[model samples]
Target: MPATILIVDDNELNLRLATRVLEKDGYQTTTALNGFEALELCDQNPPDLAILDVMMPDMDGYELCRRMRENPKLKHTPIIILTALSSVDDRLQAFDVGADDFLSKPFVPAELLARVKVFLRHLEVRAVGNENQMARKIAVFSLRGGVGVSTLATNLAAGMSQLWGDETALVDMAFFNGQSALMFDLPMRNTWGDLAQIPEEEIDAEVLNQVMLRHSSGTRVLAAPRSAVNADQISEEKVSHVFELLQEQYPYIIYDLPHDFSATTLVALDSADKILLLIAPELASVRAAGMALTVFEELGYPDEKVELVLNWNFQSQGLPRGEIEAALKRKLSIVIPYVADSIVTAITMGKPPILSMPETPLGALFEDLAFRWSAPEQKKKRPESPTDAWRRIAERMRKRAKAASS
Candidate 1:
């Protein structure tokens, strides 16, 4: 059966237009001219999603949304607020009232359809999560700084979102001045600091969702606190609890870890399904990588649990692959060539290469890596509806296999 949608607007023309657009897309839509009628309709039969116009006769969209959130039957329904008010305060008010998304009035039909598709897709994925499909967690770590840990983590998260067409979590574990949010050019509206004062038991999925920064690419970021002092308030227990909740919701969780063995870092590392140990070709980076491997061994991590990633951060005079492998006693699973200009441009623009330059070499490399690190179940079977990123990666794999055979 098609998913049911409830559209509430004071204007009959607006209601009919929205209803027609949605019905054309095979969605079953019910329209109401006011919030009271909408409530009555909702009480009789709830909808999977709702689109509300801000201006209404008896009760505005804000009030209706708040009331729906309080209603047990409709609390979890995804709400999108449509209004002519495009001010920042209006958008904030919509979100404050528990609206999932906001769109300015006179919206393009295509944009409206796109937003609806994304929310419905998310709802379907959440249902799958309830069936015990735990997310695949990947932690990107390096003992030394500036080895492109954040770079890789951000790109990996973005790539996963594009490949799977679902939201991927990019967690900034670097409490002090982490740049995950900045890399995505998202504002620091909310962060882990928001949950610092809340009791661990009180931090549920709803709370986590409010605190996360949602990127346009569908990669949600749990950013580091804006103030460094807030970092001290986040305990290891809180980190562990948050990770547990995140694993239940997201399909992929990527951690951008800071350079240290702090308790909080340990919690994330412990929870990870796979660890990407990144190392640059320099001597200090190599030494740091060795130390990290020893620590992993001490922790009794299986050999296959940790994968070595050799990153060429610099252009020249780097150690040879043979010698680096010999020194570490582990083969590098992936190697990233130096692309200084591209990296600099990406940082300046606050867009990951995977999303910005996906057809380029660097972008394609990260896309392939994301597919490789995807859950085994996802890799075993083809997606029912393959995304563009999936199709591109599949084509590349086919071409490579053909070349080898020939």
Candidate 2:
């Protein structure tokens, strides 16, 4: 679908130029001479996007942005400031006034079109979340093997999907040894390994879904490969491709990562909206989790992106809350009380505790945590592998050259 864009500027020439450029690029644009007119037009007929010039008579871009944010009708609309101000402070002020993006007056037309495309892509991704924030990406992973990583991931995704009345997908990036399929009694038929045979150029959401199998409860599983050789073929490039495709198609993309680090794992981690590092209340789990935290920190993962999850599934080796805090020297974000016997039985029976037994203590835990982690977030990083890095650098140089010419 074509996005409806509103171009608001005091100067008629600027408006005409922007409108012509956007229309030429296959966008539907509506023009307003000033902020007052734009506001009235928006209240009457809302647009999917708006580009406002900073300097205007009666109302400036900053005030216009503030007013747009205040209006419920235009609250979620993407606003780009096309202005002559290029200073850091001016950009910060624009952001403070609720601008989604900013553009300088003398910008290249290609950059303008690229920025507009970015806004449109972003708008499409966020349209669903604008009404319901709970159906967003949530990643559950761990450093140690048996801290209930898959258990938490399976149940949490099932619980969330049920609560939202939407489908949730559990992605088993644990490669060969992943238990996500086993947890749901799903087979490895046409696993992520199948994607390796498909040409990367033709891989889209529809092709990706062919490899995924649906559970009886509307939960989907992208099970890992059964063979190590096949898993080896599923490289970082494939993982990055999957994340991009999934975010646009699925409401949630939960990854059950392998116990150790891999290039593909890092790409998945970087693309995650939230990370749930499952840790047991023991010294071993704490130490392992600390090492994992160091890795994430070294890669510049924000503290807010990771939440240390204490999975207290046993009594003997259990450590107190203070003991955990003292061991890791960090406050825990969430802790699940030990729901020992029944939850294990459900998993053994190849059923998610959240769906099979929603009234159980473990199911309730998943539900409460799902509600708490419903806010939208994104990570800012380039590709993970060295080859991807080289490709990105080349792409950047090419773009710079193109911009210089333009």
Candidate 3:
């Protein structure tokens, strides 16, 4: 379908000429005689994109652009300032009013259409993975290594996608060991760097579509760079923006986070409407998890947000879930039994268990867990303070370090 473009101009000739040019290019054009009319039309029914002439009789383009942005309906519509006043100051003011692009007067019709088409194409990409309103969310996390963190995360995300009409995202926040591309035999190079460089002011869903990875399982993956310390760029502030965009964009945003606490971790904690705390039923890791819970509690994070999963496919040491929970003084939210050969075979084949053997007991367990986590919430009474959370988290880190040394 042709994307709609709202044209706002005082001069009827310009409106006629521009609308004709864009309409001929297969755009659904809506013409507004002046800024007031444009605002009214936009307020009544929003457009996908807009074109505004800067100099109008009653309301100029700058003020009109500001007005359009003030309305939530018009905020995401890419605004084009088609104006005769070509001065730098005027262009700056146009941008100040939130113009996406500017087209000077006497502009080639092709140029006008070309820029519009570019924005429209990007706009389409921006809309990727944004279709689902009801879907399950799962967080893959760990405090210890080699406990199948990536394997669990990848397969769980892929498994849940099938449950949600094949719409999901597998995000790798481990900048150095990012294996999303390698997991499914996808390419090594991507636009993750491009996304990091994008200023917050210019960021939107459309821009993210151009950067995120899309797996064949219908799951979109956003992986971090394997070499660069790009982790810092993906901070809690920026990560919050990215996750919010992804949560809306994809049915499920699979977070592949690091074992340690950092800005990204805080973002993960905040972003997780639900967090799957993956832990090995070992003495060391379980103790570390206990400390992590204390840190989360001090931070004011609610216990309801976290679902603990004990990966007991390996050696259980005959310890019960109650024993672990009692040691930590918290409840065991969820548990995933060790699936010996199934776990190994899934990772060896470079695929998640859902795809490796969708019929297996292992895959079936994850499917149920996915649904269990997806259940709608009642109300969670939780508060997280920034400074105190950090201090307590630091104390937890010290304990973990002491345990490691001992």
Candidate 4:
């Protein structure tokens, strides 16, 4: 399909000339004699890019650009000021009103065509970079090593994507020896290692996208560097910037954080909407969870934002749940029973059980957890076009509720 370009000019001759030039270059043109007509047309069908004449009756291009930027539906559409005023001050003012580019009125036909193609290309790129606005950020952290942190994080991120059919970003905040990418069997084609050398200021949504490794399960993994030396090159500022960027595009951003309270880990914890603190059924793990809870209190994070999950990392007997809860002074929210062989096989194959075995008991548990931790919009009444995954989850939930009532 040809790119749609909205041309707004009060002068009929200029409108016809601009429209003809763009249409000749295989662009679909919509001509508007005034700003009001342009806005009305935009409301009806927003264009891919807009070309506006600065000099207009009642509303100038600057004002019209501002209005368009304020409209959520058309806010991201590229705006170019096509005007006779070629002064620096006029160009700056046009940009101040959110105009992407300012072209002089007496533009060379080739130059005009070139600018249109460039802006339309930019519009398409922006559309690709701007994904779903995921409002929640969940971080899975453990104060002790080998506590199933990565396993939980990977499954939660993948399961949320499966349950809600929304974008989920899994970040390896471990920086060193992170297995987030390996858990999904994704090759490290792009990882945080690539962004380590880039300036923090240069990183944004597009830059992040360049380094993310997409999985078949609709989860995007920002893996840590395979080498510790490369991992050390990544700055805390860069990790912070990546988190800010991910929050805008993914509904659920899950962090497989390192065990220590390093600068990078602290940034993820601070920005997390919910922290799933994982602890195993062991003395050392219980003690670590207690210490973590103390730190959370010191950080002034609300109790509700933190959930304790007990995973039976070992098959043998260990600390009981009651004693662990008493030690931490917080109730355990969820517990994962020992499924050692299955978990090991899944991890070795780089397929989380949530995606590989959705019909199994372990798979159902993770799906339920994903649904419970999802954003409010996902939990709202069934959408018009529901997926099989959503239907199965809804039916299972209804059955569970009925069982409880009985």
> Can you write out model 2's per-residue Cα lDDT over 1-406, one digit (the tens) per residue?
6789999988999988999899999999999988889999999999988999999999998999899889988876778888898997887788788776678996678878876765565345455453433336777878788889888888877665555444677888888788787787654445877886676878887567656755545567888887788887876777777777776666676888878887887887888879998899888888899998899899998988989888887878578888888877788988888777877888888888876775556665666565456543411233244332134334555686999999
Measured against the true structure, the TM-scores of the candidates, in listed sequence, are 0.79, 0.59, 0.59, 0.69
- Separately for all candidates shown, the number of backbone clashes (residues 3 or more apart, or on different chains) is 0, 0, 6, 1
Q: In model 2, how large is the Cα lDDT of residue 40?
A: 94
Q: Where in model 1 is the C-alpha error above 4 Å?
A: 1-19, 26-108, 119-122, 125-129
- In order, what lDDT does every prediction score? 0.91, 0.76, 0.70, 0.84
Alpha-carbon lDDT of model 3: 0.70
- Go through the candidates in order and give the C-alpha RMSD of each one to the true structure: 4.6, 20.3, 17.3, 15.3
Tens digit per residue, CA lDDT, model 4, 1-406: 7789999999999888888888888899998998999999999999988999999989999999999988988765767888888887997788678776678978787888766664454345455765546558898998999999999999999988777765578999898789898898765756888889788888887677657766656687899987888898887788877887777777678889999999889999999889999999988899898889999999999999999999998998888989988888899999999998889999998899998888888988888888888877768888678756677789899999999999
lDDT of 1 at 57: 82
Ranking by lDDT: 1, 4, 2, 3
> Largest TM-score belongs to which candidate?
1
Clashing pairs in 2: none
Any residue pairs clashing in model 1, and if so which? Answer: none
Better of 3 and 4 by TM-score: 4
How far out, in Å, is residue 241 in model 1? 0.8
Clashes in model 3: which pairs?
126-206, 129-249, 299-384, 300-383, 312-338, 313-338
Per-residue lDDT over 106-172 for candidate 1, one digit per residue giving the tens place of the 0 to 100 score = 9899989887876676556655556557889999999999999999999999999999988899999
TM-score: model 2 vs. ground truth? 0.59
